[model samples]
Target: MPRPRTAPSRRRRIAVDHGAPLVVAKRLALVGAGTSLRPADPNRAYYPLGVALERGFVTDEQHQAGIAYTRAFAVGLRRPLALGIASDQAEVSDERRAELTIAWRLYSAALAAMSRRIKDDTDNLVLYERWPLWLLPGHVEHEADQRHRKRVKLGLDVLIAVEPKIGLAIRETRERRGA
Candidate 1:
């Protein structure tokens, strides 16, 4: 006689539960639609909508201030590079620099296709678009990813794909439940 192997199923209950990581690699903040729609937050003036993980609202932008519409055109520009750039001691090899230059030109051209949606400034709300400096062309392959980033920066895709959603959601719950 042999024993049968059983595994937990719809009818079975398990004592242990799998949960989100103890410490996420990065913290996340929910943005747009729900809470942002209710009231204008003054904190919005500090960081660009679609850039770094740091927090701050950004009602205004400037190149000098290090926050603004800079990244918004990331989809439009050529993919800059580190490998072949000219240097004082040893200027980048002509062949490599030329190659990178052509590559950059082609990259800029490629942006034309996705530029309409990816490069639009108005599309920014909760986060700035993943424009320049933040993204490079050749380094990033695939059209799908570009669009996905665009959606994320707009905060229109994941609905605040972070932990803060709990607080906002709870507040909304209390408001709805009136308790």
Candidate 2:
């Protein structure tokens, strides 16, 4: 018989950097392949965020706040904020699309809100198509295999890709002195 897969239990996880429960220190960055909208399937979106947090890459609090910030950026927690981003992107002929975009943002905000309250695989986040549209897979199985490879290759591809964006983090890790 196979054991049922489940997320880890909630607890005050210690963060190596600040000496605070990882559940407390605050910050996060969303890598969306330059995507601007909130993802439809947040579980997919939250995976990377979860991994980074679990492995002590980022403090949990920061992850929470960061996700909230992204959510707010997407849907605008304040009416003025929502309106400002909306107006900035709105055009005379694209009013309908603009409204849809706002709706998308709101949906994203709700997802982030829910996601932040938990600690688990679902709570941590990410969202990337197995392959870009330009490189569509020959079949769904092939796509799954590719995504798995990407997950395994994350250290080489995504981590390295993030080095420039997260240079400070990369540097700090190296300074820790590992075997």
Using lDDT as the measure, the top candidate is: 2
Alpha-carbon deviation at 140 in model 2, angstroms: 29
* Model 2 clash tally, residue pairs: 13
Q: Give the best candidate by TM-score.
A: 1
Q: Name the lDDT of candidate 2.
A: 0.36
* Tens-digit lDDT string for candidate 1 (103-131): 33332233334454532432343223334
Residue 95, model 2: lDDT of: 35
Model 2 quality (TM-score): 0.21
Q: What TM-score does prediction 1 earn?
A: 0.24
Reference-based TM-score of each model: 0.24, 0.21
